[model samples]
Target: MRNKIITVCTAAVMLVMTASCGADKNMKKGEKFLAIGEYYEAAIQFKKAYGKTPPKERDKRGQRAAKLARCYDRMNSHQKAIAAYRNVIRYKQDTPETHAALARLLLKNGNYKEAAREFQTVLDTLKGNRLAENGLESALTAQRKKEEGSRYIVRKMDVFNSRRADFSPMFYGDEYDRLYFTSTRNEAEGDELSGITGTKNGDIFYSEKDDKGKWGKPQTIESGLNTEFDEGACCFTPDQREMYLTQCTSDPAYPRYATIVTSNRTDAAWSKATKLDITRDTLSSYAHPAISPDGEWLYFTSDMPGGKGGLDIWRVRITGAGLGGVENLGEPVNTAGDEMFPTFRPNGDLYFSSNGHPGMGGLDIFIASPDKKTGKFVLEHPGYPLNSQGDDFGMTFEGPHNRGFFSSNRGDGRGWDHIYSFEKPEIIQTVKGWVYEMEGYELPAAQVYMVGNDGTNLKLSVKGDGSFTQVVNPGTDYIMLATCKGFLNHKEEISIRQTDESEEHVLQFPLASIRVPVLIDNIFYDFDKYTLKPESATALDELVKLLEENPNVTIELSAHCDYRGSEAYNKKLSQKRAETVVEYLIAHGIAKDRLTPVGYGKEKPKTIRKKLTEAYPWLKEGDVLTEDFIKQLDKDKQEMCNQLNRRTEFIVLRTTYGMFDEKGNLKNPPKPAKEENKHDEDEIFDIFIE
Candidate 1:
């Protein structure tokens, strides 16, 4: 009986050893697979091993759970991964690794607040975990930003709902009280799946608001323009007679390409769509169409070869033939990230969506100001509430209304995407006007100077066509001045009242021609000396006004000598006089940088005795010229000859403001100031005759 018992014990021990070896082998294989990124297979092996483990091996169960969580995370089953990570935390209290993993998962799921708390807990439990500490700080910061964003009052509009997906919304409202948008709802007439995402196709839909401000049910727009592939993103001309939209093509020969199409509305029904010839095969894709307020320009997004990255906003002039060649919007607006869905408000401000820049998540809407000079767009992200860690895009403004619609996937009870109407806070009134010559010509490129009530000077450059626009707060009076070289500077008061017109105020400035030399209105000299005296302060002030008025105008200061002094001494004195005027101007605010002083001495006299004699027979004179004789000369000749001796004058050399309008009409002509006859002969010798 003893021998038989020993045999049974030996067999039992052998069986136990065999089972243990098999379990060890399986565990090793699972770990190897996990290290090689075979998470699905590894999880299976780990599950099997755990099932075979003895009940007393509780640590093995926890290990298996942790491994399974990693596998889920690798497989992108974030919810399941999070649950597994929570189980690891339950079994291993205060463990830094487990807390870190859980916190990261929470953050990925957009649960920033919870993630922040978890990270804080880990930091409190352990020290010297720099990575965790940094992560905690980031999570807390994101939580604060998210909270702030949620405070804005957003009006929800369930404009479209699809069993599959509805996205990329574009809004257009009309005087007739109707709103239009793009959707991929089930009721849309198109193919089942999108060629790009292999999802539901997209179409255009519109809704109307009643007199009570309640939105009506949305319905698909039926038109030959919308194709079976994809058609969405519509913008209307200011007149609302024409509409611009994007049409996608799915053929592999034309993968990811979209063409801009236009249709006219007549009798409340849209005409057949016509494809614009602007699209080219070399362009990978083109989408998101927008038309300028005047309908002179068409803007869209494309992934052409020269784009900054995945997609970039481009614009082209709309002409009779078709859209001109596309031009890329570079830098600040177009980043390495995808930029799409461009819209233009009636105010001429640009709005678009981009993922190329840092934001909460996905794509966020951004605003850009078209820099007419550089032909570039300056982009600015609407931070916080206007943006979120979710895709917020497709924004449009209703005419003159501060309230508008935008699409967002933000957590506002809508599953993934929804349309929301938001009221933009009160914006300050802006003053925009054009400076032109009195000849009814528009000066497209001129420099504008705005003097605030506090005397602060703001300078702005006009467009190439001499048009100037500026933004100013209401309740402030501004001194608007436009200036250019060889033209009279313009000054006017622009009073912005609470009731100022929202449309651009058209102010046509008529500048007189600066054919004659303008007197240094405030310049003063010592009794008989050419030196600039302290009293020149007044003249310096006037010069400063001129300079501030014409920020881009450059002048040449010329000093002349009277017949009283010897030629050499007069030359020296005149040179000194020119330098003195330059110094005064520089002291008063005129950039010394722009003044070039020269002395004509006795050369190039304003009035020649022979010319004066011929013009006016009364000037039958000798070497000494009479005041009346000088005055009788031509204005240019009289002004030139008057200073044949001692005087200073200015001639415009360069200008920031252009002289002509689009039609080549002179702009900003100088007005002649009234003249006085006081010093008689001395005055004539000082200013006119020598």
Candidate 2:
């Protein structure tokens, strides 16, 4: 009987010790998992421990719930995490961290009113809690803003419900019709898990819009490009020939680094992925690649050292050789808060998401432009209808259209992520066309001005291809004018109907040839002087108007000397006269290239010398008679002779026409024959001789 009792007691002691050892082992395992960011597994282990413990020792239920809340929050289940946090506070006394987390989650879920109250509760209960106090104020501010309506709307919401994390979205192709995103779904090829989060794995997946404008089912991007570790945050060149994406390596022995990998799209399949030499630090993580339209500037996000905060937006110059280091965006674009996911529009506007700026909650998409004065990107929060009180980012416009795609987890009831399309308001019609001289030459640097019926003039410079485009509101009659210095002005008028989709008007302006003499409309000069008088300013003004009207026309200003003077003296005098005309044009802001001076020196007279002599029989050929000879003759004779020679004229030397071949050479139109001058019976020319 004694031996039996001893054996039973010893067995009971051993069992108790084993149970304690197992309990301690589980606690350590849970702690280890949580330390490595495997919150889900830690929560599971904690739950098991809570379940197996006796009711007296089951106070760990609240702790397990807290752990579960953390896991759910990491998974972006803000609502669920909020509920779990509530349970934590209800069962275990309210903690500052719990209250703060709840308030944050509530704000992110767009429960601003409730969030404000929860934050106030934290301030009232927790002493010396600055973070909670600030959070409460932020929540209250958001509530006030919410009364004005959500800064952004959640149009369409869908979720990708993989067992692992899904993140980092990018648009590709000209139409932005296809979307590429990273997912840790079961379709990933590698069995290896992330060392940081211990997630199942990651691979790139593509979803494309179909004919009906609905997203087709997502499929993994084909072989050699997507590995088992992580492939995400992709950006494509504007031409869609090359793709840059982020790849995460899982080996802990090697420090964690997110490398930029590239692939070429050919034959409808991506080529084998090649690693880029963009990784500078072994511990730093670089991801979320965005290439500029010209593919010269590359923007990305990195958690490298010397960041303003957690993850900052960085950029590197890219060329055919490789990336040229990296630079942080700094300040307003990147704060102590994380900023990532950058994209550029076709118009050179930059759109990015950030939690650093003052926002509703979580990450909100913001826009930045280089400040004219500061020479830095001035970040501005996209207010009302573009940013909600949730994580709103990863936006890309659909081609050149205002329709865009972005990801949000705002009022969407589904716990999974879905792609949403944003349609911009249509308020104007865009006009596009080519501007050319009469001779088909692509006129670069031509000024295009649009005059509204109300006389509002908007000026735009023509591209190298002589193409100009502008956006004008409907219900406006626009007079479009193209002008290049020295070229004949071209004008067209269009009345845009409200129902017009887009206006495509091709305008061909025939510039007068440079060598063709054009009569100076109102220029009046003294009989033999090259100096422009005060009265000549009016005529010079008219010339200025003509030059302004024809920006691309290059002209030669020539002066003729009368047949009486020696050829050499006449040439010198004519050159001075032409130079005077050129000075007048230049003073009126006409570019020098538009004006060339030449002294015809009676060589190319409008009237034959014999005809002039026949009209007025000069007494002697070698007679160097001055103004006295003109006075000796009748006023009519001298005036007629003077009018024939003392004149300044313009001839277009070069006319630029739009629409050139690939070589960019000027194309001249066939010349028309000179028309016989018809003397109108009503036209009269009165000549006055002194």
Per-model tally of clashing residue pairs: 27, 28
Model 2, position 495, has a per-residue lDDT of 84
Candidate 2 regions with alpha-carbon error over 4 angstroms: 1-20, 31-37, 49-69, 83-99, 111-114, 117-134, 150-154, 157-169, 184-200, 209-215, 252-257, 383-385, 411-414, 428-690
Model 2 per-residue lDDT tens digits across residues 575-690: 98789889888987988877899988867645332323544575343343345555677877776655655667787766552324568864543335445444221211100000
How high is the CA lDDT of each candidate model? 0.65, 0.67
lDDT of candidate 2 at residue 58, scale 0 to 100 = 36
Listed in order, each prediction's TM-score against the native is 0.47, 0.57
The stretch of ten residues in a row with the least summed lDDT in candidate 2 is 681-690
lDDT of 1 by residue, 1-690 (tens): 999999999998787677667767778877876654456566667667656666455566567668877776654456777887776665563267678777766765678788778877788877755546645654656556666664345666665545434455545443336777767666777656552333456777788777897878888776675667678888876556788888875553322457777899887788878877776564566678888765678888887788887789988888777667678878787876578988876556888887556455446777887775674667765667777656677877655444578887666322346677766665545565666653224555456666666433565555434555555656677767676654767666777667534544566565533554443434557755676778777756656666666666778888866555577877877787889888878877777768899877766444333434655454443434445556667877665555543556777777644565887776655445446522232221221110
Candidate 1 Cα RMSD (Å): 21.0
